[model samples]
Target: MTTVSVPSQSRLLNRELSSVEFYARVLELAEDDGLPLLERVKFAAIFAQFLDEFFMIRVAGLLELDEADLGVRSADGLTPAQALGAIRERIGQLLTRQAKLWKRGLRPALSDAGLDVATLEECSDKEREKLAKYFEREIFPILTPLAVGPGQPFPYVSGLSMSLGVIASDPASDEERFARVKVPEGLDRFVPVGKRLVPLEAVISHFLPMLFTGMEITERALFRVTRDADFEVSDDADDLLEAVESELRRRRFGDVVRLELSSSASQAMHARLVDGLGVKANQVYEVEGLLDQADLSQLVAHHRPELKHEQWAPVVPPRWARVKTAGGVFDEIRRGDLLVHQPYQSYRASFEAFAQAASRDPDVIAIKTTVYRTSDESALVSSLIECAEEGKQSVCLVELKARFDERRNIEWSRAMEQAGVHVVHGFPDLKIHAKMTLVVRREADGLRRYVHIGTGNYNASTARLYEDMGLFTADEEIAADVADLFNYVTGFGRPQQFRKLLVAPFTMRDRLVEEIRRVADAAAEGRHARIRLKLNALVDPTVIDELYAASAAGVPIEIQARSICMLRPGVKKLSETIRVTSIVGRFLEHSRVYWFESGDESCVFLGSADLMPRNLDRRIE
Candidate 1:
């Protein structure tokens, strides 16, 4: 018998292209007429924000790649520059589809539904008069018209900020001039003016003559700039927070990677804006209809409940519903293990209640947790503050490098520190991505540690929009493992072996691979074997190779990924037993669950780390 080997490149898909495909799915939701009107609008706004982050980080990284690295190719064999070109081409198609949807589908449908994003030309005479008065009194005072002159340099257009590029001509001197007027961030992007929602930019554009009073405002082009927002802090930095703060400051002046403009802009104005920004020609994206999809969020916020998805109220998990004692929640967890699913089960009743209970419990001597991401109104932050105030030791491992959430995490970390909690921003390079809480209580027996671990961030707002699972347990071995993990993060103590739990950057990847191989062995023996995975991404080459091998050995694999799956399923021989699907809908499928069966019993993992190299190798899951 002859054996054939499939090349590694043939088994994988480009990760960057895979991500753009995810957004394409999101855009499809906006085109879904079966969806509630405002729900469609919400998806549209989300898609725009997704693209913003994609360019800010992913494309920005590609643009900044050094000459040597740019030549290196990805798993599917496209070099960095080639990937950027592919991303650009795909983005162009997405934007075209998005624009068509907005103009032919959403906008018209919204108008018929009485929730329209209107133009000044669409306003009635009486409504126009009122809006004009409103603009002058409300928006005009906030506007500042900056022009390029002998002493004045071109204005710095902040990233993602919508600004008007003016081609103003001086009538007296016959001199052609250029100026920029920044749309006020403080004002609403859209304003309600009698029966419709008006984009604030139109109002600003309507009154641009007022800002550049005497000069002839020849052309008013609306455009947005997306600059490089990705940053890194040195591991050697003594003060990680200070280092991050410095990087953030430097991030503001990062080279502009993308320029978005109205499709109707004049040629001269377009060239002038592009030249002033020093952005490459290929980087500019001319948008039709609304220039910024994010600005449509104001329209989605309108009081039209009938046009949106039915509101969901997370229910209290039956276990915590009847608890009345100050620390009764912890006692209930000890009674039996508790599992709460977010957006279905109440986050407030589960995690928030746990933190509150720990703060109130005189028995709880200490509270330790990791903060990869959280909300401004984070219950854990307040709970930790309260616990610290009550003389309980409160230690928080705040990850200050959670991508776009860095600034907010920094703010939360500083707040925790001020409240006397031991706030430890994890290492600059090695991010602490695990989401778990360790509560030490002075019980009658001795020191009992209660653990709350989850497959999502400890954020209240996202809890309602993201699907996640969290476990509240007093299981001795798991509790001990979590405690050890916390110690390893804050101080130093790496256990040689973990009895039950799998801690990442150490045990997770190897353990998961071992489970896969075990199941493959069972399948090869003609026994029952299967693998099921639900995650945000799966790009780790090592794990992917193992999966392919398992599938070849007759093990059945089912993968449901939300974004960026490198694994190409349904291959004739290499992965005949593997299946892949992506689920994107009202709720973001944020939880990660990897279940493997050998014969009868199954091994399952639930955590924050995705099957990606960086998550497995650098992050502490």
Candidate 2:
């Protein structure tokens, strides 16, 4: 067998691209005549939302890393300062592209479709009159203008809040003054005055003069700020829950990582804002169109299905109604193995069925599950509450530090605790990442355990958008392994061996490495060997190195990663046999699937794991 080596410079993908360039390309692709108009609008909206999350998490994380003086370099070989600089440069370009998309591409296409996002200047006389009345009745009551002067300090700017900075002169004294008014979240981001929709910032900017009757309005511009939202938990904290709550409080007061001002902002005003927010000039972004594009999601609900992808209703599993009517989902599991593909198949039918079964089954002795992110109206949580009400043994390991969902998880934790559900925060350090549900039942032979393992969260709402996979099995070995995993999470037991399951923080990574080595050895022996991995990210250096080694030994590797792939594919002498591609479309690729060709035999494993360092090294079962 001939082994091939990949050259370093032959890598296919860059470590990171300018977000501005990335989005500009997205807009460019969206405007292609080959794509549908509605699809283009959806792409535009998605690009905006992606930018919001990038600011919230990635930018926030980088700021925190710099503040803590961690001095850790990213996989792309850039320091925090360099990363921020690159991000700023990229965002400026993206903002320009966003303006172009709105002003040229989407606006015209929307007009053709009879849906226009009109500005105050573009409104007709009758429309203006209607807007005036609507503003007086609806928007005026919610306005709170904060004056920045000697007696007042800068107001606390909430994360992602769009506000207007008004420069006004007193009619009597002719002294310049600045006032800020945040667009209220309770109000719609897009105010529909007549048939046309207007941005709330535009509406507020137009009516600023009316609010200050005695003042001469000189200038006004829209601005927004992104704050550090990443939470850090102390290892020695007395109570994890209390520590998380305190951290959540501090998240609001975190150092500002970004300040987005209108391009027309005066130099003095920009300097004042930079000083007030304690951010550098490079951190400032001048947006032309909407300050926050995430709010464009509101326009997605304009009852214009023609402006978006066709609605996709999830398919009900064949056994769903049968299991639900049988008063227990475990009965079906006991009879046969079940497979579920999300978005195409419903998560409510699978997860809700587990909870519903646990709540009603008298023979079921215990129920245990791990929860990371759930909606405000979670069917899974509701079922758990029902189990507690029914006096069934229900234990939930709710991870309070699930990033953006911390506050919601805290509220859920309190609610679960109040409902008599034994809610534990899992290990103090490790996050419980494995998605599993254990149901202990009294069987004819003895105690039997049924388990459900999945590649995604137990959340029903996200199932419609995120593509994932789940397996329901009553196999004693796998069920026993799941029981051991639950015990390891909630108690002090660690299984020394697993028959069919791969768990992190123990043997998952090692097992994967071993499997890759086996394929490499077989390839070296002139047998066919291949590996396919589909994941959200690929950042673990160890895993990347192993894959590279396998590639050197003639093993073909195919990877489909949705975002943030550290490993560069198609590099000569390094990863010549490896190919990586990302698919972003109607459904978010969330499943982590690994398929290995073992010459004469093949194996597949699906679970809640990504090839990230934190997931492999720090997270628990």
Candidate 3:
């Protein structure tokens, strides 16, 4: 057998396509009948929602790159236009499988299980009357029909908002009008009629005539528009927060990257949408079944718990669980370093309980933490607020740049500020993404710092659904490093260096590469060398090159990348010693863990950062 090393770029895979493949993995779960019904339904919804975001951000950016002729290329060397073509082709194929999963599989299964998702045609006359009354009372007041004619410009289609393209004609005036009706976002995607659920768009389409008063509906089709929602704040903007909010306001009208139409859409309606939305034919997608299969989430829940996965309550390890209740979370950490594998272990018992105890502990002097994506009623945030109310010094580094979470973070920042907690919005140019907390407590010997570092957000809601890692340690070196990290984020100067932690945009990438090279050296020396990485994405070209170097040196490397893996593993000598796997299941795998070994010594690091260039070089993690 002959072995050859492929160039780094040659070994790279298209990031966008890899991301779609991740969604396809989710769809596989949805298509598999062995899983619980609602769990499969959940995956189906997640698959659609994932693709929606992929288009809104990734595909939209590519389309813009193509339009601007910037010649932007991905790690795999595909130009923007070329990537768009590949994406369109891939999504078209995925959509077919997705539609079949719903119409041919889940829909029938749900009907057999005594839950029906009925179309307008399937509704009985009595059911129709009931829905009509319900619509008039609950939905009619919010409906707005915009007519397009000589003076009427096509109504602005907001991104991801479902709507109806209506063709209505006035018999008396012989006037045919093209109109659009936006489905109310506040209402459920599927309305209840007896035991059956009806698509909201279908119901809206059924009553288009009443909305137009004198006009008769000739044809109607459900449609959705996805627009570019990605924006960057000016580094030197007078007010970064204001700039971000302004950009969010403008995001609604961003260039339409995709226009999805129901298969029932007439050629005339489709043509009108494409023109009005300024979307190209390649960007228009005709959906065979529901325009937004993500809405299936609303239709899938059943009264029978058997239809859903068996509820599993997170539990603390018996070792820590007893110690936590007996002495405290601090006592448990003081025993040694502790790891909380979330969902498997209760976030409430570990992270939340830790914060709550710190806030209430009279011996605790000060507390500092980072907030990226937290809930409105987060126990963690509330604990900080309580700590502040108790006149304890508390600081919060809230990253206002967390995508899709800017508004919520902004609101939380303001509330924390009002509560007298020292709130920092972090840098305008760099988002502080490290999930860490520092608690300074009065120990008998001296002031000892306790720290908690995690691979997921501090959001309690997601903790139950996202598989993450949290480490509680009283290690002085690591605690000092965390304190320095907070100082860098909140105060003037960065630490010359971190003693134990790998902070990003400064030392994380360099340290990671150095560690990888050390493993490669060990392999060359005929010593044991190995590496294991688990992250949401692995696309940094430099890091991939390093891994390739290590693999060629015979260093065994295994990676569990949940999405967007660029490195092509098991490729002859180029990556013969490296293996990559993506695990997609009931829970989202979001933790980032990196391990390296040389001879007998092993180094392990877990953090909020992934191996992507943005995370390692641009963001502050």
Deviation from truth (RMSD, Å), model 1: 1.8
Q: Can you write out model 3's per-residue Cα lDDT over 288-311, one digit (the tens) per residue?
A: 987787877775655678899888
lDDT of each: 0.89, 0.79, 0.88
TM-score of each: 0.97, 0.93, 0.97
Clashing pairs in 1: none
Q: Give the local distance difference test score of model 3.
A: 0.88
Cα lDDT tens digits for candidate 1, 164-254: 8888898999887898999888888878888888988898898788787688888888999999998888979899989988998998998
Worst 10 residues of 2 by lDDT: 6-15
Candidate 2 lDDT tens digits, 245-268: 999999888778788898888887
Ranking of predictions according to lDDT = 1, 3, 2
* Residue 161 lDDT (model 3): 92
Lowest-sum lDDT 10-residue window in model 1: 1-10
